[model samples]
Target: MLEYLTSLNDHNLPYPDTIHPIVVHFVIAMVLFGFIWDVLGYFTGKTQLFEVGWWNMFVATIAMFVAIIFGQFEAGLAQPYSVAKSVLNLHTLVGWSLSGIITAITAWRYVIRSRNPQKLPIYYLGAGLILTLIVGVQVYLGDKLVWVYGLHTVPVVEALKDGLLR
Candidate 1:
């Protein structure tokens, strides 16, 4: 069972890179750009940009869930060093919470888009800005997990295999 689970990270497939980061960049780009395009559309009265924002948010809503799934899978396999445990736990919590938050916001955006595709309400834009801010914080947390704590990196994985990391 342990061998089977560890084999999922074997890097033998066509896309050998970590799956979480691949999926997550899509979420990050879509959410941030979706908010940006919406704000620009609101201020400049460009209805076309609203279309762009709506689509971006819609795709981001989906991609964020995919990213969260891979994140949970990879995090489960991670054996972080003692000092890194709290940060990993926090990142996992935020990742799951962000998934739910993005889903709710996307549903709200869908309603607004369905009613009137051209104009977005100020409250919705405000909420999107807040969502973008939260995403930024999540990005920071993810960076700390990978860069500062070195989770799943080659060296870290080697250390784990050698029982050098707790």
Candidate 2:
């Protein structure tokens, strides 16, 4: 049982890079584009774009949850130390928060779509814009974990194995 659980780590994955990032990019793009299309559709009075936005938000909502699950799993196996710990914690916090936020927004979007697919309310767009900003911050936190701290990098892994990080 322990071996099976251990084998679920990022290192044991078939790919060289982690799966979280791959899955996360989809969430990012979909959410961003979803909000964009909604905003554009609202201004342009384009029903077609609203349709696009609704589907995008729908898919993004599902993908964000998938990303969060993989993120939590990968984060558990990260074995972060020292400075990376704070970053990882923050990233995890925001990741979960964003998942909820996105889900809520998607629900709101769904209702708005069902009621009036022709356009979204200004306040909803405002909330989406705010969500976009939060997503930007989340991206920054993720970047710091990978680029600045090298959480799962080969050298960092070697360092951890050698007792260089604690």
lDDT agreement with native, every candidate: 0.85, 0.86
* Residue lDDT tens for model 1, 77-158: 7767798999888888888888899999999998998899988999998899889888988899899988998887777777
Worst 10 residues of 2 by lDDT: 6-15
Assess the local accuracy of residue 113 in candidate 2 as a C-alpha lDDT between 0 and 100: 80
Q: Give per-residue lDDT, candidate 1, residue 162.
A: 81
Cα deviation of 163 in candidate 2 (Å)? 0.5
- Regions of candidate 1 where Cα sits further than 4 Å from its true position: 1-15
Stretches off by above 4 angstroms in model 2 are 1-15
Residue 108, model 1, lDDT: 95
Task: Residues 1-166, candidate 2: write the lDDT tens digits.
Answer: 6666445334533346688999999999998999899888889888789888889989989998889888887787778888899989999999989989999999998898888777678999899899999999999999999999887788887788789989
Clashes of 1: 0
